[model samples]
Target: MEPSVYREKWSALKNAPGNEDALSQLARQIAFSFVDRYYQDGLYRAEYIDLLCEMATSFSDTQFNNKASSALFEIIVEELCDDYEEMPVEIYSRVMSQVISYCRDVPEGVALDRRLTDFGISTFDDLYNRANLVHSRRYTYGAGRPPEKIILLSRVTIGADVAILSVMIQRFMKMFPDAEIVIIGNAKLEGIFGGNPRIQMRRLSYARGGGLFERFSSWHAALDILQTEMPPETEQNVLLVDPDSRISQLGVLPFTHSDNYLFFNSRKCDESAKHSCMAELANSWMHDVFGAGDFCHPTIWVPSGVRLRARRITESLRAAGCRRIIAVNFGFGTNPRKRLSDDFEIELLREILKDPRTVVLLDRGFGRNELLRSASLIADIGNRGFHASVACFEDSQYPRTSHGIIGIECAIGEVAALIAECDEFIGYDSACQHIAAAAQTPTLTIFAGSNNMDFIRRWSACGDTQCKIVHVNTLADPGHVDTDEVIARIMEERSGKAPGAVEPAHKIPEIKPPRRTGKQAKKAVDS
Candidate 1:
């Protein structure tokens, strides 16, 4: 539907009593239409943005009592930030100011605002001006006298943490040899990077599916942690690096003194480096800031126990005559646009099952909806006369099938370990793809959603492994996708032959391996 139609629908319901569902749906439609038009025409419509901001204000007035209401507001705000440069400056300022106002009106948001004020930011404008000033200065600490402690904030998503945060940790480790490194984020960081001795994890939970104020509450939680990490007595001796992290709401909030803080605006890319992925962009930013030498590709450190369990699973399949293992994940994490049609997944699985020597370790993705989707996919495969097994990560028994599907429910670390054991990994543009690439496994990523070519370039998996990206414009119509061509490209990737229809991103020639192996790293963690 066009923006005008959505706008009219929203107008009728904007003030009417409690058709909250319909109002929320109309708001979402309007927001998505705005994004689609922006991508298609390469222009931002100020009228549409104004309408979105007005709708967000209305939702906030209701205190975002419902999940749908809060989600609508978040969608609008995120769309504006996704291509922030294209958004008009006045509109951006208005929306951010409204966000601050909305936060002040609620208890959690009030706490968040107080925290920012404590850090010397009296308003949204104040935070942005100070952050921009820091960005322009691009200063680094003295080479001879590095800070005694360094704090790195998590990017708040597993994929970004693997691609960007891990690179920063490695680079910082080298640059400031004696600095104590602390990470502020969820427990998942421990699974991914806990093995590093120099790193410490401080938990600060962000509610991904909560209301707007609930999501903002993490900033307050982050400040509480920072108070313990960097007290006033030694504030100047500590440095905090914000990698455009969500904890700071993409640098909309300040955590430390500007002189002691460094923010890497991961979204800004020059004309010459427009196609660089986040890992590459981060390395370049570090180089420019500290004159740091060498490029660091993405890396992960799976625990030894997880690796051993993954080995047992793969060995069982190998003994059953399956020579090649393929790990696959289809979850897209709250974005339906990122996924292709069910028919596409079914056809792709059928094609992979054609090879008798290959076994597919399919991931039953997180959450109820994804679990049901995977279950249906498995049933569809069985109806077509193929054998399948469903098991958990801790299951000791393995399916002895030579060429079929083994659907497993596992944790993130287990998924990484399984991918590490596999001959190759296949998935959508999700965290598993980044994890697979970091483990040095050849990866095939089917890129869907977003017409933004720059977004695709910035997020392409980066590691010292073959990563082939097949961009399928499924946003318009999934039926238009050539399933046969995609299957052929997958086959080409497996055979180590140049893909005919798809082009692979250039691989980083070498990334120094982690300081310790899985078992050795395991010992360090235990000790």
Candidate 2:
């Protein structure tokens, strides 16, 4: 063998047979030499590149001092280049990419693992981080393919922030009607539209798993699915709504592309307590990912228009005596641990029947208590007592009803239907809020928190004139206040008691900024 070949083989097996110390030392020396030599010439022969990659991978398998491991990893990555001759372009590119991933992650794991051992906290995040390190190792360093279509990704079903999702969807429809809107969830909340022509849905299987690794695997797998299944001619404007605080901190929001990348953050206002910290972390993340040339974006506050539409439809339907409407909720379907029992909803049946204007609409899948409670709240103050037209709205199968108080299964346009039929909205802080708002109907939104109210406020086309937000003091002390309070507020605002008090005049309606006309998309990415 030639001198270099022998040396490569020796370094590759340096950590063999319990000689970890020698192995680590040899790896460090080789790493330093490669980085130093490349810094001088700004290039590497194909043979040297291959050897360096192999050495780094071998070093990655070793358990060494965390700092030393980190330093070695950095050196290996700093020396990486795409130029090579011996291997096919494809294989060379793949190997080089994998090597760079190891350089970025393995050393970080080595350090994090050691640090965690000192403090002793065994949590899901630790496991997730470890898996992330391994996952990063699998990544091959190469340029990403240009996106076919830039999508605005929202995980509306994962949490209860329906109000924000509804407004965002409406704004997206208004701003980019030509662009395809794909929601990253399987919830049937869109069923309200009687089948929306513009929106598409994709499911990420994060909800099925039991373990931390499974969820991470699901998330990573979803990313792969997204990349692989994307069409050849898709738009290149992807935006992910990352509301989670911790993950946003890790810089997941500032996604990269072949041409351009942009980070969106809202400054700390009164909207979300978590907003300031999340923005701070996102700022750091932007710096790490994009080197910080203004990571913040202008944000606008708005109301949930979907709820307004739904409430309006509910009112119209009641006027028509459409008493068989089911409140099927495919979204938020069955979380026994978190949701109230159906039997509890059934108890409100008495209050609903008192008005003698509506009847209970029942279905097998619909939870009775939940629907009844919703019915009671909506029916409580109407001139005539009210009842649910349908028991369930969330369903894969279509219902026969021409009119009813549909729940979570429906979509934006359905609010128009509800507005045309129903008397008032009995909507929660879900996407229906925006739909109701868009329909310009009386809506009462039961809010859990004030986060994302900015976007929520814009969906209400009446500029907060048609809707009222009701929030309890605490989650534990949950109790319904009289809807009259909200009704009074709505009426008072509509009467022009104080236009400034209801919605500030300075608050602009939230909408996505148009792409720059003159610049290439990559310029946007860079900025």
Candidate 3:
């Protein structure tokens, strides 16, 4: 009979036995029966270890707080070595507690056997399980044939990529209405995909042995979905749209036989000239994910200047009952552990806000408290005349956006809307600045007008070319200026009286003379 069944029968036998010795013998039989059934059947490895540890703990703590019981517990610990490498954290913690309890019971001179003393396998197992739990709860790239393929590309919290996620889901539904899209991410990523039947979601929790493997396992459901919808027999083409920047090399994917192509959905190569090395690598990864040998994939790159919906910022500001708004985008790239000083970007913002007539709306993710300090400095400057307010979304009443779903309370989409409503946008180079430009707001971008300025000028897509489109440098004399210079230029241009646009002293356009290919052309130039 099953050990559980035998144990139950023994429980009844204890009540019906003739004496205490008989009951004790039956109890021993029951314990051995459980070990035999569980171990031999390979049914409850975890349960067996837990039960043995509990028995050893109780025995050491009460009756056998001596050499014999201590030795027995050590034997039990050694026996568990094979499976300890993959044991769950909860189980490991329970077993470790029992081991520690048993160790405490041992007399001062009682030494653990050399074989039992070695904790390398057990400790590694425990740590591995713990790490797995952390990763299990995070975003995963799943495996095998899934019913559908839903890929999330994000460098930080997935919330910042909500615009892309939402668009992808909507597009996926349009392409495959009957199918379900599985979203695999952290606990904080739940509400973002809620109320969508086409979306089946799972949270990866490392706390529950949901580490990297578990994270990968969550994607198994996605693989199941992909397989169902896109079987091998059909030879369906799968395109990987990676916007978060890391692109695998051009080759066969590590797993699966599906003919798939990777697509990078970022504007990395839109500039007229080359970018920095890191920027180039980010673009390269996107292509590599698509199996493109070179970094640039002409056929696959998303045409530059794709339009996103004008998430009306001016309207949101008006609804919030604010007027004469100034959106300060003081976002800078910095590592969390690094201490921040007044960099070039911060210096420019301080000088720009010297005029009291401007209000400041700050993007909070720039550099932690560094951003707050920059805003505070700007606030100090603006206090003399105009009212200044920092834009934040911590209020529970504020509806959750993609960023809020990821616990990054402030939403870039909302900031974009505010910039649309504001009189001017000022900031260092960042995605927030790009979003503002997309919103058609006048923007003052603080880039030193050096060699890189040529690239910046070509890439900038802001509609209003007046006061907002000015660029500055770190070493510019008299710091930076804040005014409606762009507005002035636009008004003058409209009135057909702008000095910059005014015809030069010579009305005729400069034409290139013929190339000096021969002596005649050279002589004409010399004359």
Candidate 4:
């Protein structure tokens, strides 16, 4: 069936009378059609898969009381999995888990274990154990048989790319001086790591906004690239490093032989190092895998033209008598829980503006929502009788306004360059914090939402400069946070009085987990 016809039928059934049997049957049919089209015609429709998953989850037990309905649901699962071998492991797991949860009395012949075995794992625990074993290995490279090419998969997100992959690239350059290093990631990587002659970036796009199964499309492209780079004739002479990349669904999919593949299970490795951040963990993993070497801090090589543009902006700010430039970004990536309330942002801006010589170079973040939020923040701050100027990347000059917020909308590279020029950086637990630390600028990160101490420790910005985190349990109540104390701690870090202080001011008490909204619940299933 065509996509439009299937969508129309699904919508009609959903809106029509309470015929549970009909809805379930139509859902099974659409799912089977999806699997058939994907296998027979190479037409993988993400929307069809999304609809099927939604229907399966939305069905109540009353709908599945009959044997036919239950059998149809089971067929849907088995057919989808059996035909499409390249489906992402995470997506497959999510769908199966949801089905099992709803169908408590699943038939003995469901073949859950058999299906998992097809993906090279007996269970989720087995997957982690295998990853842990890979990370624990301390293999020494043969002195005479270094790989001819090193393929480094991207960590997908900007923050992880900077904190983890950059370190890997730097270490690989030093370890195998003759091997050609190829980076597989998005186009933005060029702006950040393009300047290095030793590293070559191969662009592979991953749809960050696509449906769950849609994300797996990039893996096929990456697989083709790997085949061309590492043919069977020369497989042993090439190395593939997987840094828990989304491209391969965190190394669940096989891209090369086990001997030639190295997966850096970032989440599981270095569990005993409770205080170590991801950058530190990555460095430790490198040392263990390649023997001990000098620790490499995360680094970015901004393009020369981008660097010049950043310098012009900073110089314009300095020419306006702004002695200290502070780069601030409030982007929280895909997780809205990591962000604080608007009042909190306003208060933080107020504190930074207290220094008459400091000028705030605020980033009007990406997407419509973030852009709107940043604009609202600037307006709210201005209502308190503070000077604010809005600027863009195209502007060759900035307003001669000192001790005020200058909101600018620019690219990621521009933000990195500005951070390089800044004396200090401040933001939420987002990419800018990592970028700032990479530039060796003192950074203050106001971490919120999560009380997971280990998570906080693992994600803290790492660099030679001072990187401090102020934990706020905004998940419970943002208003209850001691804004005064938070601001004071930030100022102390700014004054160089608390050098190397990575701990939060006070321990964040454990609170009840927040109930996930409908959209958040869907996102949880998608992830």
Candidate 5:
């Protein structure tokens, strides 16, 4: 053998025993390079991260596979939660995509043993657990193609519900280009979920009267529609997404006549920072559970009429010396954790009043709570010496549905139009923020301190550079936010000021785990 051949053999022997470190370091370098080059916008991050993670999985050996995977994991964790509890959605997608890819290659019935560590937290266990979950589940499509048609069962109820479906539907359309799409949801969704060429909407009739008999009749009608719409059971690859899965709970899942199903119940996701984001959870539940990998952002169809009216309305506001209209929707009834105290809302509005070039447009009519909050807010307007004249309204339906009590598509349409015209939208952890995202407007989403960082990262509207999140941290007393500083940042953000120039009050609070004696680390890793 040549002298070079001997040296190569010796080096391979020397390095093969402990080369994961070098490989990991190289992977880290590559990850940093990727973020540096491609981190221009939110959508860009998603594209590039997807590409890299997909490419990384192709290398199944040590030099590229394990170390690169480990590096990608750490970089993902750092980018997502190093400075804050969550990274942007694109980054989160990249990490999750990498996890799926890794799971794809992991041996069956095997626990992954990468032993990689980021921030002294080894994510091998987490990735392994998630990977195992991904691997073990059986999707109906099996090794063949996806179904010819996807039937999403009827359960559309509110604005947030529409917002969640927007992106997922967009992604599904892209993923299964030729696949027929059918939405059997509330009749109101016809407007909110209209305008897609591929989508065929079947109006779902539900009980409007809040009566047991009416609801019972409505449910029967829905069942009849479902039975009529679904393809034969022998038909291959039909996906039925009963998001919020109440039908399955009612034992009517068999009626849908499709084996592939994804069901979600909204419990155990609030209170602590330990949940996956509401958005991501929705998508991931469908993805991991139902084997649908496509994920997209909320979509809103801005009708020309609505757009024209919004522009005219905004122009009128500008004509009336309303400097920058700051939209506020601080009331959320989904959970108390998402609801801000009236005092906090008032304090922030009072702070905003100090700025002369700014005007606050409160959301007064979305929910019943909002009506009360708005009344209180208007009552407190005198405290800041701002008159009722600042609250601008024409014949616009935007004011009518500001409280969002009745979530009809017409109301959502008007609100979407109005939000599209606003400079900034401020809302709590609810669907209004997602609507702002659909409008491509800048939003300041004040997140409640939920222990599930995954939930926050996935669900919160961060896929756009314009969306900013300030989260509450609770070590023991748990919920504390500097509302005043949040207002200042909101103002600076609205005025197009650089972030670092402003005094920082927003934080991604450190989450303290409940004091349990055993397996805190394991539980955290699992969580």
Candidate 6:
């Protein structure tokens, strides 16, 4: 689980030194932010509460005032129980098990822990049974020919790389022809051969909608779906596929296997193990799950119809006198804080428009409203010293005929197709970038606001050598990045010029954040 506000502040407090007061204040502010969100979300999100627990623990450990932190925590928890439904008992217990250890006063901690446990909250095991018990119809597979069944448990959602997960499932079925496969995970996940005839899909009940026992029952039901779906073949291969989960404790997966491929999926991996990207981790763990498999980057399947539409769209843009078609996704939908600042974007726009033959197709997806807020935000480039044609999605010649920054959300299919048709792609860490890379489009990803550079490398368009990732952690300001540098990098990519060749007319941005003079250097979390 990731903390939204205190992530950087927490690391800073742990590091100790300059801005101690500022960091502590920020920690408190972050804590309250969680509390506000928790109340706003109607306390259904146990995850947010878990973040609060962590904040309390951090602040109570001399990082902040223990007495004040304890008071706030007590009030928050008490108010939480008063307002929320049944409350997330198991989640609280999981958190409180350590919360007590973090408390400065053992007597006070003991009293608090006992009172909390008395809520009759179901334990983790009980929750698991209640949630996933339905899916376990027959534990063992009956004797038969080579394993005839494969069950996979995952949590992939619709907005995520459903295509990659889909392809993986399809590949698995192809890899083992005899095994009948069933993928049980997120309900919203699509492209699962709903009618395409690729693989089977079943929805795992979400734990969020229910109370204590009910929640775990939902979780157990998800697991049970895996169990009951298993074919009772002589060779049955049942596997759980949550890379982030600690499945070794369940004792269901085998410790070893005769087949390397089957063995990889049946074994457990240390969650603490680090990898560059979740894909890399998934791939590695997948290798652990299924033995040696062909390495493939994530990609969405573009139907022939979509391809033809994209071509028409591109051709129309070309005929309209927009020469170089560059695609841009500002990733503001996922997290606006991470979006490229107005200054940087404006600077980049000016530089790109400077090329007479170049016309950028900005992918202002459905969430563009969240980024632009109003029409006034987008400045007229002509007045900004560059004559560039801009069009909103509503324009008759919008995405098809006119090429400019369309500040409106577009359908996923259209976005993918447009990206496929473009000459080059520019985006932040987003699905657009991923899709573009998967399509083998030349992409320049500017990642400056992530918690760590590892995430950048991990998610970097694997298998695409043409992809250029520029990691900038500008210290002076993060939200406002070095647009000039990004522009230079873009030109370099197009001209095949060596990096940093463009002479900067102004100060070059720092690759890393400004170093603080504190004793220990604390880095922020990767967002």
**CA error at residue 440 for candidate 5, angstroms:** 2.0
Provide TM-scores for the models: 0.84, 0.42, 0.38, 0.72, 0.55, 0.57
Question: On residues 32-119, what C-alpha lDDT tens digit does candidate 1 reach at each position?
Answer: 7655666688565555544554565455454434434354445655565555253333334454554555556554456766766777
List per-prediction Cα lDDT, in the order shown: 0.73, 0.36, 0.36, 0.69, 0.51, 0.47
**Model 5: per-residue lDDT, tens digit, 1-527?**
22233335334534564555654554465567555644554333333344334334444353454454455545653354322322342244345534443443445203222212211214434443432332233343354676678777654455445555664566677667888888876755654555456777777665432222223344445556656666455344666665542222221213332346544433223333244444444554445444646454456664456566666766665765666766677656435666556767777777666666555666665656656667777777665566543233336443221111111122555566667677777888766787776666677788774655655665566323366677654333544656666666655655564343232233322321111112111101000
- Indicate which candidate wins on lDDT: 1
Error of 4 at 321 (Å): 1.1
Cα error of candidate 2 at position 214, Å: 3.4
Question: RMSD for each model, in Å, please?
Answer: 5.3, 18.0, 21.5, 12.4, 20.5, 14.3
- Once superposed on the true structure, which residue ranges of model 5 sit more than 4 Å away at CA? 1-136, 140-148, 154-163, 177-179, 195-198, 203-221, 231-238, 250-252, 258-295, 302-304, 321-323, 389-410, 449-455, 473-527
On the 0 to 100 scale, the lDDT of residue 245 in model 5 is: 29
lDDT of 2 by residue, 251-338 (tens): 2212223223232322222322222222233333333332323333211112235434444444544556555332322112332322
Could you tell me the C-alpha RMSD of candidate 6 in Å?
14.3
Clashing pairs in 1: none
Number of residue pairs clashing in candidate 2, backbone atoms closer than 3 angstroms, sequence gap of 3 or more or interchain:
78
Quote the lDDT for 296 in model 3: 19
Candidate 5: worst 10 consecutive residues by lDDT? 518-527
lDDT of 3 by residue, 201-264 (tens): 4544221121112222333443444455446664333333334321111010111344342333
Off by over 4 Å in 4: 1-140, 269-271, 499-527
| Model 4 lDDT tens row, 267-320 | 552334455567877887787677777677678888778777777888877887
Give the candidate number with the greatest TM-score.
Answer: 1
Q: 1-527, model 6: which lDDT tens digit per residue?
A: 23554566565555774444665465456446556765567443344444444544443334344322443344343233222122332223333333333331333345333432443322444333422331122122223344455555443333234323533564566566766666566543332233234446687654332222222244445534543565234223554333221121122222222221121221112232222344444454445445556554445555455566667767877887878888877664334545667667666766666677566666555544644532333445545644344454334553543434434345566677677777777877666666676565666777665554434544555323256677666545765566777778766756674332234333322221111112211211000
lDDT, model 6: 0.47
Better of 4 and 5 by lDDT: 4
